[model samples]
Target chain A: MDLRQIWILYRHEVRSALRDRSIVVMSIVIPLVMYPLLLWGTFAAMNFVEGQAERLTSRIAVQDAPPAHRDWIDSLSGMGGVSVSEWMDDEASARESVARGRMDAFVRFESPPAEGAGLEQNFQLRVLYSAARDRSERARSQVEEALVLYRGAWIEGAREDLGISDPEWSGFAVVQEDLATPEEATRFLLALMVPMLTLIMVALASFYPAIDATAGERERATWETLMTVSASRGSIAAAKYLHVATFGAMGGLLNVGALVLSLRWILAPVAGPEGVGGGGLPLSTIPIIAVGTVLLGLFVAAGMLVFAIFARNFKEGQAAITPFYMVTILPAIFLQSPDIELTNRLALVPVINLVLLLRSAIGGSLALGPGLLTLASMAVTVVLAVTFAQWVMRREDVLLGSAGAGLWEFLRSHFLRRKGKA
Target chain B: MNREPVRTQALTKVFYDESRGQVRAADEVTLSCSEGEILGLLGANGAGKTTTLRMLSTVLRPSSGKAWIMGHEVRDAPEEVRANLGFYSASTALYPKITPRETLRFFATVNRYPADRVAGRVDHLIERFGLGDYADTRVEKLSSGMKQKVSIARTVAHDPPVLIFDEPTVALDVLNAIELREIIADLRGEGKAILFSTHIMSEAEKLCDRIAVIHGGRILATGTLDELRETTGLHYLEDIFVRFAGARNAGSAERENAG
Candidate 1:
């Protein structure tokens, strides 16, 4: 196996892939443009919805309140987010109005408050609203808040009448503190999304090029010519694998960069001004993530090339590669759960280990041992996949497009036949 | 006497078919092509013409046999064998996205042609094959004849001593086929040992210095045209082939009946 020959084959594969417009569009353009647009669109939509919600005014009606409650109803009208109106119908009619969206909510007082009940007042208040309607729910909460304030004022007035001036009688103060830094919280949120997105983009980036290089050659009837050349099958397969791995790595990097840049705006409201980058992963973690991306890219690319070569044509290659893509994605989705961590056992798994390692690395908590383990595991798998690809290429029936047994059955028979000959 | 550029001893290939048990795609066949000689492998489709050519080119492994290209054993030294031989089939295609020049350069580099001589050799072949106008055009945009010209140029880019062509004219128009015959004659003039397979009797008659009649994975006869005619008592090559194939079929039927 000549390294120069491998380089020549690799260069040709890369040049061919570059010339293919579909591969260029799928790998580079989509990652660079689509992610930013998708992120910007989502953020803009959320902002618009929030603005609309804030400007909305909800109407509330009072039902069956005695004339003596006029002052309290007038106070409710003075508050914001509500337009209190007279209820000329029964309780059912007020509820029907709320359900129909004509009124946002209704406050039904079962009976007028006892004349001088003071602190022991025992009156039933029912707040009716359509839970399915956002405005109705908002209006009900506002009305409830106003009533609580009014009750507080009444209690304060009674306390003044009794000449009680101690402020401690209001309630005990409850203070809350969040232990997480802005970075840690942002990392938590990004850990769920970034890894999955990166894996998906890597798969997409490598898919077309892998299929184009292997099965595409066969479909174009160029495989036989390629095989007859002086280059060893191992060199040829390695060159193709390098071409696919380069695309996969580029995709992974571009996706991470795009996600980082876009999430600054996309997650601003959720993660604050520092956003996805703020306090989350340190600048040092970038190199670690970069390394992980390359390893994962190589792993996935090798696996995809092996499967793609089994197919006789481009469409058949796509069909053959879909299940592999799905299998890789399943582990990524499983890794999205915060409960799954980078443990020794998990580090032994292929795709799952890479995702976990990336998540840990990006979140700035990657331990040295497990990170090394994940890298080593992926490297071994890539080697095995590439070896298998080289073996497949040497088979006469496969290279010549002759009808034969399925790959596994053929390999089994081939090995047994060799053993018998020996 | 010139050295033999291609030789085989008991070359064979067996394919296992679920319905037919074991099918001998190429039986224990032995033949040789010497420098400055053109050996036309004459056989109909499915008569092991391709299977035999493929084994000699090291594209398919012989089940139990030895073959050599320019004295390099195919199985033991495939890279050396490939370095010394050029194989072309009618179905062989060029990379569609690459230009003809680029295709030749790729082949030259892979075949380890001297780095300094690749460009000059490629240019000479381009002019020789009348591909100057489409040398820089993507192969997918080239006409079928032009593409075949590029294919043949790339096959011989390293100037190997042995050339194997399998049905090279099967897809070519009459003009292109005639052009290919001229190219094969030129290669022979350059003292390259050329073995090509063809079912077209006239093509074999016009181009082959010697003919090897193949049928059912075995060569029935091999000699000069007159020598073959004298042996089979048939004047035309087609009638000679029919007699050979018919006799083999009758023998097989008789054996089946006896069983």
Candidate 2:
């Protein structure tokens, strides 16, 4: 309860943690550069794979076509990345060849032949290809593209033959337009990704600091020294919990900053420069993101400390903390489903609610009532996590890791013993 | 309020070790140290030296009996007991990243030293522990000897009237061990009640104003070196320790046989 003593211990923990390489790397360096570097790596990998696919030659064969289509078949032989060949076999044989991978695709002409070799003629064509093979699929698409060009030219000739001066109307014309601004388009996707990324990054950032503050102290033989100080156990717990939580929250916000800055580039591969706009989140939602991130840090950080303190050594502490980190962030991942919205019932759920709150806030559709409800649930969860951490600090088994006991047995003894006493 | 700076009445601690079943690490340990006196708890390893001192420092709660530090009962007012006591053992360590000056200032502030006087107290501890040369360097970068010096300085940063040294020289070289002995003697000279524990007979012979021989979690005998010699008709402190510890072990064997 002594604020001054807590402040003293808190400052010391911060100063020491800043000097730790593992903590600094996770809390600062990773947040600042992890998103951009990972996105860049992914972007480069995609380009490499696309280039390889582009270089692959797709083989196609023309079989049993009438003499009039010989010119089109000959032109296909000269097309880029298409090695077209003449097939002397029957239509069924050509199809079998395509299926057996002897060729990428086959083309055949059905009977009920054209009435004449003129613009008014009607023809039946079927393209054969495997859906599983990349080359077959590509050949099919290339054949379709070539057919489209040929049909356009045929349409003009048909108009001339029919004595129709206007070539614009191909029966009916359809025009499409999008009403979304570049920023709005960017925000739509950002709303889905930012919340999940925030949860994961913040959870990861606290991983090392939590272990260093708790089990690392015991391993280095410093916990006894710190415990000998005049501060009450509650004060020490408060200071340690806040110190680690601040690091986690700070890492998350920095990651958001880095992510926003990298947004234009991350989306550039899909949406050209102008398509994604400046890639900034809706400015109005910053306050909501900030408050939600802080509450999340509080809850997640204490969860990490509780797990870490239960372990006997640095290695065991890491093993204990990894699962808790995954568990906290895993719930937020479910929010990736666009079907999940900030409904009245969903807003009462803990981390899922925060994700919904952030998603709604970013999408510019957040209702005040749901937003407040989400924040309240997160606050209540934070209070519980912190109170549990403080109470655990008073336990001798927790303070001095349960000697030689399995993690479950350690926990069972403490909780059961305390309950029985009460 | 207790007049003695350090006092205890039949202190005991029982640990539940799976292999050993129930072990009494410290059994009804009664002892006291007055101001300007160094009371050496002379015993071998696992003879309840550390456990007894740990109880007095309020780091471990006793299963039974009571202890006081500067007039504050350990169980009722642990924070006050910690504020008035300085505990230094081989296991107590400093933060490797902070400078010695910062370590001292932090300890002083947290131990409830007045805000304005913290700086002066830290400066005094630095000089007292001879930490002037590498005081600014990170403790990890300092040599082992220098790190030990910082550890000693941190123990007395709060200027507590009661100080406990529990096998502090166990990990130190001979030169650093001598330096620490001199420091303990100097603290006693300044009227601080000191409880020094060690298995080394020469250490107790050279420093302790009075010696308490302990064995099997109990203090077998307590007296000045001359007083003990007078009772046992022995000149050497090692022989005297054996006389007490040996007799206690033999008595346990006899009781076991009787059972």
Candidate 3:
């Protein structure tokens, strides 16, 4: 309850944590190197996969092809995702064969233009397939793409009046929006990372330290000295909890800062000389994120402290507290999925809210109420966790780590005797 | 007539366990210590002496008993009790990264001493404990004896009315132990009620005004060394402990309730 005590504990905990080389590496270095590498790698891999899928081909049979346009139509077979074979039988026969799953897709080419008269050149390429088949839709799309490619040259020749000769050779017209706001784009990109990273950082910062300070103390026999001090048990627990929570909050803030810096540097080259426009998220959201991150850190720390305090030793505390990481990580993983909505009910869920909020921020659809609700829920959860941990802290078995055989003998003689008779 | 610093009546603690059922870490134990007195609680590893100290310190809550420290009820006024006491033991861990000076100052600040007084108190403690040579060194770099000295300094940084030690010299060398014994006697002389737990008979005999033999979560016998010797019909305190703790009467309820 005393702010000074809490601050004192927080300061020392932060100092101790910073002194640890592993924590420093995890907090600053890993994210600095890993975030850009992972994001660039993922973007490159996705593009590669899409290009490969576009290049794949499927064989097709041609039906009812007229003589004049045979050459033009046959040229379509060379395009990607397409393979063509001539129709040997009549229309009825081909139709029957197609229905019985005899072909991937059957394309019928219409008659070509006559000589001298200049009859309109039009080709009806009908791709036939049963809808129920797995590859039918894919087969249909491939045929369509090949046809477009084959007629591309002809379409350009027709548009020669507009100086469009050799249309196939003319490259695409690039419409650059000249997006000037790297901060906005960065926010968008980070909306996903921020939520997950914040949760993870908070949980990590709070959990291990709380256990080390409390249950670890008991296991090491240091809790005895701590108890003997004139500080109240609650005060002691609070001090420890506040100290760890501050570490968690610091981690979250550092991660966010690192993410922002990385964004500015990476996007600088691509946003052209005229820097990205739109003043990122309003300044108001900064406070929200900061406060939210701090609260989450406290919640996780208090919760973890409860568990750590109850654990018999460092190893036991770890075992007790490790499952919480999953709760923190789940929100980040769910953010990766494309199909999700930020809703009021989702806000009440702990890490899930962080994910949704981050996604909304990135997508430029952030709703303030949901984020506040999420923060409130996190606060409630942490309080409950701390209270439960305190309850366990009050127990002797947890405090003394079974106390060996004397405890068993005392239980047998003292109270169990009365219980058995009843 | 009003010098008692610690008082307990039927102090007991029961722990519920999922795998092995229930455990009683401390059983109906009543005892008292006057101000300026050193009471030594002697027991084997699991004899509930630590648990009893924990209860008296307001660190562990008793299941169905009452304890008072510095005239404050441990159950109802834990904060007040904590405010008036200092406890130390071998098991008490020191923050290894912090220097002895920093650790002592941190404790002092938390106990709400004036900011100006912290430096003076810390310097006095450093000199008193003979830690001037390594006051700036992190606990990780300090010798075991030096670390013990720092722990002692940190525990008494606020100069509380009560001081408790649970095997305060368990791992130290003889010289450090001697220094600690002197400090304990000095603190008692300054009118601080001191309770300590130790297995060493000599340390108890030298320091304690009264000694209690604890076993199986209960205090079996308590008296001055001569009083215990005469009552148990044994000249040595260890023999007296063995007599009470090893007796068949101690296991009578255990035998009747065995399933």
Candidate 4:
């Protein structure tokens, strides 16, 4: 294939794409401005909802409690956002009230855990609430905390009466410490949002360009003219693929940059300064993330071109590419779950593997073996997609959108024919 | 004698349809156009005019038979064939976002015109096509006629020895059509072999040194206008086409009824 011809085609496509307003908006404007706005809007909404939830009062009902316990529960009335009411009914009735929203939650003492069971056995208090109802769930936790505080006060009084001063009577004290640095902590939070968002943005960035270069040319009737040029079909396809991949890579870089800036400047301050480190993503992991992102862009760009070329027009191309876009994005959604990791098996999958690799790289946990395997697998898939695109370009029926006979029709005419049939 | 600039030997292309079985879009069509001559392909809609031009342009491969452009086999040396031929159709379009100057430059470069000569060739095409006024304007903002001019200029930017025009004046206005006819005549004078397809009898009568009437993917008649008139004893080219196409249609109907 002639490199000069390919370069000519590539330069023309890129120049044309750059002049398009929508392409400019999607690849550059959206990453730089829309992302920060979206981040700011989401954080503002979350804060507002949390404040509203805190101000709402929760009603709790007490059932099957002794007089002494009832008095103790009554003291919770003075606490903020908690309303205590006595229920003179069976446990079933109290539970019905909580379920019906007449009460947020109900606390029941189970006969002091049976008197003869043992002194070692603690009192059994059951808090009934529906997790589906936010207020009921909140009330259950609040009541549990109140009960624990009351129990502690009672224990201290009993100890004073027995002249016991040692704190060991309660239990051994447990101390917890987090060994992660500020950067490591930020990486986890950033990994949850950045890699997935970046993958999706890169796919979006390549979508319009890929479709415009392939199906859009056909729609405008320029594809035939280009095909009649001296350039080989493979060279033309390679040039288009390269043009699309550049957009994807640009999108990835812009998104990563915007995300880091937003997190460090905008979101971190809202998250009270400890949200993300001053410097986002360790310096050591940048190379891995960058390489992984570029490879993913190449893979996505080639895949989009193959799908887009199957369409006969711009609208049909959009329809054809939407499913692929969804397929690429749906797997990246799984990246949101922190539990998913870059295992060997996951590293073999396409979009998911890239997201996982990015996640690992950001978190500084990327193993060389799995990382290299992911990159190699992505490269092989990209090569296959590009080859398929070139082959499609060479097929007249495909490029012309001519309706070719289906396999079933071919079978009916040949293999399925009866003996002596003309 | 002199090497034919474009030649096809039983160049056949068959398309298979589920309901119609094998449809012969172009069937055993043997034809040639020598340098300094214009050969007109006359056919009705779906009469394989576009298909034949497509095959010769190296845009489509023939199922059976062979086509050559300046001695380069289309199947074996498609790039070489494309390099030596300039193919244009009503469907040929320009990149909307780029100026005509850029479009010409791009085509010239891809056609492998010498890097040093590309600018000169592009400037010449702009002046030749009278595109200088709006040559730097994006194609999308240009008029339909201007776009057509740009398309034609780009096609001939490499100055190939053979030219193929498939209904090149289909959507053009009368004045632009006349201008295009003049251009084709001038190219023929320049010794480029030209194969043009059109249904307009006047176009063929005025420009073609020889005309081929194709019906149902087969060339039914091939001769100059006077030769065809004498052979059919018809006074006009339209009457001659009517007779051949009518007979072909009747023969196909008879075969279908018999089957």
- State which candidate has the highest DockQ: 1
CAPRI accuracy category, model 3:
acceptable
Candidate 1 chain B weakest ten by summed lDDT:
B1-10
What is the overall TM-score of model 3 with all chains considered together? Answer: 0.71
- lDDT, candidate 2, equals 0.86
Best candidate (score: TM-score): 1
Q: Measured by C-alpha RMSD in angstroms, how accurate is candidate 1? A: 3.9
What is model 3's C-alpha RMSD? 9.4
Error of 1 at A180 (Å): 2.9
Model 1 off-target regions past 4 Å?
A51-173, A263-273, A277-280, A401-407, A411-422
- Write the residue-wise lDDT of candidate 3 on A1-422 in tens digits: 56666677667666766766665566545544555665567657887978866775655777676675665555666554666788787777766666676666777765544452354567567678656654555666677776676677666666775575555445685667947366566565556556777677666656656666766566656666555554555556677777677767777777666555544554445554334223333455676677777777767776666555556677777876776666666657766774676789988887677667666765577787886788778778877877865655555554555533232343464468659767
What does TM-score give for chain A of every model? 0.83, 0.81, 0.59, 0.75
For every candidate, give the share of true A-B contacts it also has. Answer: 0.82, 0.79, 0.71, 0.82
Candidate 1 lDDT over B1-259, as tens digits, reads 3399889898899987767979999888889999999999999999999999988878888898899888888899888889888999976789999999999999988898899999999999999988999999999999888888899999899999999989999988899999999999999999999998999999999999999999999988899999999998999999998999999999989999999
- Specify the poorest-scoring 10-residue window by lDDT in model 2 chain A: A112-121
Model 1: how far residue B100 lies from native, Å: 1.9
- Is 3 or 4 the stronger prediction by DockQ? 4
Order the candidate numbers by DockQ, best to worst.
1, 2, 4, 3
CA shift of B184, model 3, Å: 2.3
- Report the C-alpha lDDT of model 2 over A165-282, residue by residue, as the tens digit: 6745555766678888887777888889889989888898888889999888988889989989998888989999999899999988998888877766675656676666666776
Better of 1 and 2 by lDDT: 2
Q: Which prediction has the highest lDDT against the true structure? A: 2
My TM-score estimates for the predictions, one after another, are 0.88, 0.86, 0.71, 0.81
Judge candidate 4 against the unseen true structure and give its global Cα lDDT, from 0 to 1.
0.85
